[model samples]
Target: MIAVRISIVLLLLATLFGSSLYWLIGQFPGFVVISLGTTALQFTLWTGVLAVLALWLLFRILLSLIRALVLPGLHLSRNWQAKKQHKNSQLTYRGLLDLAEGRWASACKLLTKTAAGSELALINYLGAAGAAAELGNEEEVNQLLALAEKADSRNELAVALTRVRLLVGKGDYEEALPMLELLHGRHPTHPYILSLLERSYRNLQQWDQLEKLLADLRANKVLGDEALRQLEISIRAQQLTALAKNLGPDMASNKQALVDLWGRTAKSLRSVPVLIAHHAALLSQLGEPVQAEKELRRAITKGWDKELLTSYGLLGGELAAQQLKTAETWFKAQPDNPDLLLALARLCQRGELWGKARDYLEAALELDSRSEIYAELAEVMGRLGEHDKSLQFYRQGLLAVTGGETQLMVRA
Candidate 1:
């Protein structure tokens, strides 16, 4: 209805314009003229107006014709682009899946092939780098990681972390440390960054550096409490090992160093039986059996650890009788503990009391017939001049090593 009304209004205006033009032609007969150096061009004003309107009509027709001719191909081009993008995306997805499934070679192939065109180009290259690392292709891993780093600087952290993790996975801790330290400088509080640094330092046995990271690790809660305790134990153990390795023939200097180390260790960590056992053993090895026996005795008195008790029996000094007494004291508390019984047997043997050692070994054997107990008992019996019984016990030791817990013998 609106269009019809507009058409009627235009027709009436055209009629009015024509009638007014007729009247204007009769009234004035006006003209427009352009003269350039005596050569003159002239036309009626109404005719000039009609010519301008005709030109505008022709231009509109040409524009519509051009659009009609080009639009189909443009649409087809866009369709082609969308299809290529979709294909590249599918390739990226499949490459990631292949990586997850451990298909290293195939994942690397697909990911690198479509990486340049893939919209997820960063992900593709990173996945390819991982696959290359798993394949043990160090050269390819470097190249792919370089490509990942260059392809997207926006994900600089992701790229650097991937590179570091790959290096660590391949046991290249020496090479990875510098990069990880650099990352730590930038992302000082980043948890994963701290974690990666921890792993790199740990794998390299860079305990001093790792020890420095412990504060950050605790602040970030990067490792659980139990794990942190274990880490401290390992570090302390390594410290002892290092001290032992670097020692010279000076007994006084060595004893002072060991004393300093223990004093510097945390009071809580001192209670860890593993480190105490290690320190005690080191003391014995360094000709400080008196100190070794004391450390073991104090630690054992606080806690009944099998390893500590065993180490207690191995110490030798003026306190051989005292050591035996200490181990025997635990017998009342851990009457059925096979390890304690073994410790008593070892302590008795160290004292040259073969009969008492045999009794301890026999008591321990009744609880658990381990190969070591059988062997120890056989030696004690031989020392007591029971050669026949010693031979039988020796045979049983070998059988126990194989599987004699359930083996039965007929009574003769």
Candidate 2:
């Protein structure tokens, strides 16, 4: 439109200037008004030519001025955009501060007013989601998160974090499971995403998913010794729980399903001790006590655990007897391991080896005195006809119980 306007003006100027020059020349064409004896027609013709050239040059100068004028207009437009963006940024910043201060209503208003193209818009979505979460408006939170997810997916760092958080917040662990798996499959050492995925799966009781994520973390050295130890303990607890829950009398029907699930979980865990224990525990529960015994023994040889003793005792018969022997050996190997001593005490009491059981129970109490252990020991002593010792143990157990119950009440 501007080009057309300029072109039309240039054409009009050329026509008017040419007409004026021609009129000037034609008006005095017959007069001999030459300063150096030049004919009037010659002077008129030269003057007309000069006038035409001058007008053309002048028109060009005007065109140049119009073009030069556009730079300031463009600069002003850019300045306006910058100011608008800065204002939006300020809005978002203030909104975030309000959110931190728990002023959800004010935060939401400020964030909503921010422009979308600014980084403020992204922060606005985050603030709005937080506000919604605080208000317990799940639907509003979901809506805001969905918007955030859509926007962040177009950005590199934001995509994984946003999607995982959204799925987790909604308790959709199964759906949230893939982002890390897909990313780690490509990048192999994305420590942060790996940790998030692992935690999400763990919370959902998806041991198989958790196992795979942990394997990646371990492979990348993202987990330190202490963290790895804690992870192993948690995994062990979960596997044992799964085995105990899934045990059924109809082995022929449920055995394969149990084996497949446990195996898959163990395989994904990079063959951890907990998975081995899980497989054994499941097999034992399924009536293959022999295989379960072997698995437990292997786990014991690799590391010590109280779970093996409890599980072995639950197996009963020769396996249970063998477990007792293993427990005793484990106790002897690591005498300071109070749980091992406790397991030995429990196994001995089951086997009617009353004297050895009493000895181990006392040793366990010495290591770490707890109400449950003392209670069990007192019961065993009463059975052995040592009424006096049993009463003493019972009084100690009562004190421990009182303290424990008090602590629990305080926590509650």
Candidate 3:
């Protein structure tokens, strides 16, 4: 209705303007002349105005036709691009969800599909690599990792670290170390690089390299306090054990190497219960019985470790009598400690006191019936001429070995 009213008003204005123009024409009676190359045309003033209005209306129609032909294609192109991008985004989301949910095969398929068209092609390829690894497809994993690296050269560290993690998870430590070492060289302070290098070195049993890397790990705060503490103990203990393996038959030279190697480490490391136990075992292995006994005795005096006390009993060389006396002294303090009782039994065995050893083994078994305790008691019974009882205890120990831990806890 509004359009109809506007059209009626326009028609009335045109009619009034036409009447004014006619009056003006009667007053002026002028002519308009147009030249086109070799032709000439002539028009009155009203005719010239009408011709100009016709040309303008023809131009508007042409312009409308052009726009009507072009705009929809442009809109369709833009709409297609938007829809394609949205589809890619949804696929990326689903692919990552599958990876998180441990659907290895589905994630591998989705993450790799249409990845070349994805904006996050690197993420797609890397995620596919992880899933492929879980699916035990090593060839596919390598291919995906290579594509991830090619997609983002600037993120080579991320790609390399991902590969290292996969290798380590597969127990491919030998294959992982060279890559980890190279990456570690370039990105010395990167936390993840340090962590991966640490894992690779640990799995490879490269304790010396790990020992050297530890200071950096601590300085960079790569590992938490408890983890670092436990790791340090393991490294130090393994270092001592490795040192014992490399020693020659010469006892004096072995003793010197042991002292020098252990002495170079920090006093705090020396005080670790496991390290001290390892060092004592090394000294015993190298025939430094006096030093071995002293180390165990000193650690025990400073603090009470069931393991250290146990080691003390096992290291009875020429000092078997005194070591047994010391363990018996501690028995008064920790009367119910099974480890201490085990230590006392071992010390008695070293002294060849079969009756006493039998009594201690029986007492230790009553506290905690470990498989080793059963075996030891069985041996003691054999030495004491109780063949039937020895056979029964030995049978129980064998069953514990074949079955669960609690199997030995019940008397056979």
- Compared to the true structure, candidate 1 yields what TM-score? 0.81
What are the lDDT figures for the candidates, one per model? 0.85, 0.70, 0.87
For model 2, the superposed segments whose C-alpha errors exceed 4 Å read 1-109, 116-120, 123-196, 210-240, 248-280, 288-315, 318-341, 353-360, 381-412
Worst 10 residues of 1 by lDDT: 403-412
State residue 412's C-alpha deviation in candidate 3, in Å: 17
Clashing pairs in 2: none
lDDT of 3 by residue, 252-361 (tens): 88888888878877777788888888889888888778888888988887778877976787784688998888888888988898888888898898889998988788
Better of 2 and 3 by lDDT: 3
Model 2 TM-score is 0.58
TM-scores, each model vs. reference: 0.81, 0.58, 0.79
lDDT of 1 by residue, 1-412 (tens): 9999999999999999999989987887778898999899999886777788999999999999999999988999999999999998888888899999999999999999999998778889999999988899989988988898888889999999998888787788888889999999998989988988888888788887888899899999999999998898898889888887889789899989988988878899988888888798888878888888888888887767877877777666667778888778778988998888998998888889888898888888878888878888888888988877777888888988887553322112
Q: Which ten residues in a row have the lowest lDDT in candidate 3?
A: 403-412
Distance from true location, Cα of 165 in model 1, Å: 2.0
lDDT of 1 at 212: 87
